[model samples]
Target: MTTALWLLLYGGALAWLAPPVLRRMTSQGISPQLGVAAWLATVAATLLAWLAALLMVIGATTDSVLKGNVVTLCLELFGFSEHTPIAGRVGSIALIGVATLTAGLVALRIGRCLSRLRARSHDHARAARIIGKPTAHPDVVVVEADRPAAYCVVGRPNAIIVTSAAIESLDQTQLKAVLAHENAHIAGRHHHILMVLRALAATLPRIPLFATARHSVADLLEMCADDTAARRVGTRPLLAGLSALAGHPAVPDGLAAAGTAVVARAERLVTPTRWYVQWAHRICLTSVITGMLTTPALIQVLCHH
Candidate 1:
């Protein structure tokens, strides 16, 4: 019981404390890929900690109930009587009930968010396929819109949609660069990661961490895709292409070329990376994630013994 309480407190503390630390670390121009990994790791570790605590509480309650019932039955057989500790029983029941209810609500919220996202993606993809013209690139589709826009859709048929105006505005190299950027989003499965984060944020709007993480990680993922596109096409062309498309509208169900943190991403692309500093940041984040996940279990084990 003592172990369970400690685990619960530790989990809650880590959940509250991890976000700011992660934000600070990631803001220092660490590798955006590493930033995404760190953020995901923090969320995963927090969930693991809470799950461990809930399981511990459930296990302790089950053990107490079985022991109390067995002892009472044995005493009654000998013409004696014993009562279970009402306080402990009630407390255990309350904790278990609260945990169950919270878990159920979270699950339901995630399910709803996922369904809505998938439905929207499907609807948009179908519309794009119907309205957009096919291009030399089998996966690329050209839509007849005056606005200079490019975005990727992940659905029944994963696609890169570029507007007619974007085609007219960009040179070949710039167009290729922009196409590469959208391709990076598709290749990296960034949509799936965003979906998970969005679902969690929707589920826990009150918890600032989830909502903040959703937005922060979205920007980081864009940086990650930026790096990939830059690697494919020289950074200059990519920057020019992105600049042309900057401030273009974004689709809620798709990842747009200039949709997220355009100025910051441009600055990051121009700034040179310090491999040594990035390595150090990676090591620190890895250590923190490992500690967050293992500390609660270690405490429970120590208390048990």
Candidate 2:
């Protein structure tokens, strides 16, 4: 029973939490401070949940024993006795169950919301029609829009959409650079990463750690795109193009666009401190991954028994 309850609680929590956490971590772009806060929150929440589950397991075992249940024999092997308070044990179990259920439901709801939003974006036929055919390049799509933009839409048929306006606004070199950036997004499968982080955020709304992670990934992706563009068209032209396109509106959710967050992205590109910023971003991402993977392993090793 204890095993069953533990499995139910932990499994449910993870299921509820994973999608949004992963999605958010990869999406909006997070700062190091935000990532640290998120990691700490995740650690704290997991610990609290684990402790709660443990107490409930103990309480449930106690209640069964005191009620003269046959399970008492098995429980005695684990060191619990029949003199424990049945009512208190029952209450503890009930409270833990309720709390777990509530948390799980919240996570599920958030995931569902994000999923729906993504689905709506992907399924919009008008946008798909506007995007025309999928190109040889996984990231590049020619969309029929009057405004210039670039964005990566995350999914199985993930793509980057560019508008005629973008072409008109950019010189040949700048246009090539923009295409390189979009290609980088597709090659890196950045959209999928963003989706995962977004889903995780949806699942665990209370965990700002996932949100920070999401932001960090998003920022990295942009930097990656910028790097790709710089390699081809030179940083100066890329920065010029970015600056020229800074105020362009984003493509709708499902549609891909070239320049989203144009102003900030341009600023980052122009800033002399770019290399330092890139280094800091990489370090933060490393820390987040390390913390996420290590904490879970440590908990399993130390607490599962």
Candidate 1 matches the true fold with a TM-score of 0.88
lDDT of 1 by residue, 1-305 (tens): 45655666676676677788888888645678878888887777667767776776667666656565221111232254653343356566675688788888888889899889878887888889889999998588899998999999887888788999999999999999888888899899999999888998888787666777898888888888888888999899999999999987688999998998899889888986688977887788778767766787687576656
Q: What is the lDDT of residue 79 in candidate 2?
A: 62
Report every candidate's CA lDDT.
0.79, 0.57
lDDT score, candidate 1: 0.79
Worst 10 residues of 1 by lDDT: 69-78
- Residues 152-262, model 2: lDDT tens digits: 565446656666677678897776777777767677666655665667666766665456555555655676677667777788788767765676555445323233455
Tell me how far the alpha carbon of residue 294 in candidate 2 is from the true structure, in angstroms, after superposition. Answer: 3.6
Q: Estimate each model's TM-score.
A: 0.88, 0.60
